[model samples]
Target: MDTTPQAYRPETAILDLGDAFYDPVTPANFPETHLRFRNDRAAAEVGLETLGGGEWIEHFGRFEPMPGSLVEPLALRYHGHQFRNYNPEIGDGRGFLFAQLRDTGDRLMDLATKGSGTTPWSRFGDGRLTLKGGMREVLATEMLEALGVPTSRSFSLIETGEQLERNDEPSPTRAAVLVRLSHSHIRIGTFQRLAYDRDADNMARLVGYVLRNLYAEEPGDDAAAQLLDRVVGRTATLAASYMAAGFVHGVLNTDNINVTGESFDYGPWRWAPTWDPAFTAAYFDHAGLYAFGRQPEAIHWNAMQLAVALRTVSEAQPLIDILETFPERYQRAVSEAILWRVGVVPLDSTRDRALVQAIEQGMTQSGIGIDRFFFDAFGGTVPADDAFAAARAALVGYTARKPRDHAYWSGAPCSMLIDEVEAIWSAIDQRNDWAPFHAKIAAIRHMGEALAD
Candidate 1:
């Protein structure tokens, strides 16, 4: 928690190499490094106006901590059941909170590094991220943010010039460093680590820190209960957003769940082209643990894991009761989101149920284009044959490829209907006619403004 600012110097920045919590750093030996993207606007938002350039060749390959920032050596100890196997030997291996800054909005956020170097938790591997992996994360996170999902933003991408080998993908792979701006880098595993290690005192301190920093509005014993409730609510709402947006967070590990309830750690994630509940993006999810349809369940399970970790200090019954509200909250938020997306305001549960069920059936049967369907529907363009063909093409990529599911379509001539919409959409696709569409949606939204007057 060092508040004193120091002159920015990449060379003089404290490495804190001796901390066993991360992989030991060998001086970054790289041929070249590069800066692919610099989030100048995001950096400026957080009052970080200056940045030092790194050798592009070196960065694409080993990460060296950028000098000139306060290095807050944070060991966020937490436990997580990886794939449901409770493991206590987990912590910030090569990643740690470097510094936190209050942004222009006056909200405190962390500037954390991945692939900075190895720490005690670096069991037996190099602490470098592959260049491709880093790029994917940057793209995935930004897309999630634009889709209105609560997510971490990538601050910067620096190519660490190092030659590393991995079993998957090419050997002697290039490395890069990634910077993420998030509400808090603390995860559920942070709590589990202390709880399983019998470090209740540290767990208490960590919980207090979380409350003070992230859940400041909810404080004390009652506040802590409120914080859990807020987490539950936020988690449910976030899951609903994911569902509405057709996003599947491939990894829903307890350690990946943020205490602040913001979505971070996008890994092997994908957008469900069709509304299938069992759609999962993670290639390694042999058991379909964190699929698109199962996201709410996965979130609830993660929350339960968090509740168990929180039980060390907080009352278990209250936490459990709060966790139980996740399903209802998820259902409500998801229904409301769909109505909003479809340019309609939901009036009752009956309407919501009908719309959602219809959409699901359509997606399951004819395999609708989630984005195109909504956009076309919002534009009042009915689907046509070509549009259905495009949707079928999109569905070909699903893991569970169902080509002839009669129950899905309910005999709706989706192909012809979608093709009709496709014709209208095709005609206007290139025209920058945001004016009309914007006005239409705006009018619908401002119907309230008119009513109030």
Candidate 2:
């Protein structure tokens, strides 16, 4: 392995925030490190693209702290509402923030691990991650990123030689450790923890830290209100993006909602096959609480929780005012997101909203698959077929962002439907053949590059 000095400028800014926010923890020793997936695109962000597979496995899988980074991992402390019920006991039980580095854009990013070890919050269960879960997350992040969603990038995935017992899936199942590169790991629950304790001083300090790190350009005066307003906008944008992508996050717990507005911690997630508003991703969600259509509501609920937490530092009225803007922000964002995905520049807000509304109605009435609708209607051009006549008429005058002459515009769009994901997993699980999975990832990346322009 070439151990050349890399351009990884490490930072421990989070560690300097306060010891009350996290507990120091050690990573588990995996018996084996079998590199399964490496996100070269994400690696390039942090200047780690030159590292060999062996070197990557040793550093990520083995939990070795990158040089000049944090010497030890930190299990972040946070309390969240799980299913609207407050759970003060929940925290990072099976993962830790391994290191932090500056990306090519000079933005701070954290290299965090999942299924790598145990922490004080582990309670009574083993701190391990199933290999299937890791694979699913990698696919979810890749697909979501390609769809232009602000999301965490799956940086590395390495299989650990272990058989784990679980009731959720067939067990004993294989295990692995995953490292995700994300903008930040701080969550709404992080503030909830301080508010729960009624520690106004620490709450104020946290607000300052977040404002400086996450929103550096914002005015320092009334930072709490400014942060809440920014969070509301970002959260609204996130909900809109999910809806436009036809993604159901399944879990919208406050802890799952990152403070930086970047989506991470993929659990039970799925893309809607059709335009079913009630479609759910988790089997346990019998009530459809976090269903496809209800995601905006769920996110808004989480934002209110954040506002409640911020009350410890600022007045309640300001936070409430910011929270109330969620509906308008979400509506505007949904229109903009749809326009972006359809590969067109919105002529105006009213026209864009009408176009989005028309498309949604058309999809529902015709029972069109979301992916197919987007693929066929690139640049807002509806098909000549009579079935889409209404949709075509709705977008007749819209202009494309660019000429739709790319070869990508001619084929079926890449989809991450459940069946396709299962088939990819089955090939690896049954035949031990990873060719399908690799090929699917390559195709998804190609789609992403094509759409990125």
Q: Tell me how far the alpha carbon of residue 361 in candidate 1 is from the true structure, in angstroms, after superposition.
A: 2.4
Candidate 1: residue 77 lDDT (0-100): 54
Model 1 misplacement above 4 A: 1-31, 49-69, 72-75, 346-350, 379-453
Against the hidden reference, what TM-scores do the models get? 0.74, 0.96
lDDT by residue for model 1 over 1-453, one digit each (tens)?
644433222221112322322333343344555665566556666655454454422322243333444434454455688888888777766566665556655566776767766666667867667765676676566556645578888777766677778886657766777778888777878777766766666666666666766766636765446667878888888888888778888888888888888998765777777777788787799999988888888888988887887777777888878988888888888876665555444657755655566655665666767766654543122356553444333332223212222232222211112243234333333462324322322332332222111
Candidate 2: regions farther than 4 A off: 1-6, 384-390
- Model 2 lDDT, residue 418, Cα: 95
Model 2, 1-453: lDDT tens digits are 655444768888887678999999989999998999998878877888888877898789987778888999999999999889899998999999999998876788899999988999888868899988999999999999989899999999999999999999888888999999999899999999999999998888888777777667544667789999989999999999999889999999999999888899998899999989999999999999999999999999999999999988888888888899999999999998988888888878888888888778777778878898888777767656566666677687888886667677777789999999899888988887889989989888877777786
lDDT of 2 at 83: 85
Clashes of 1: 55
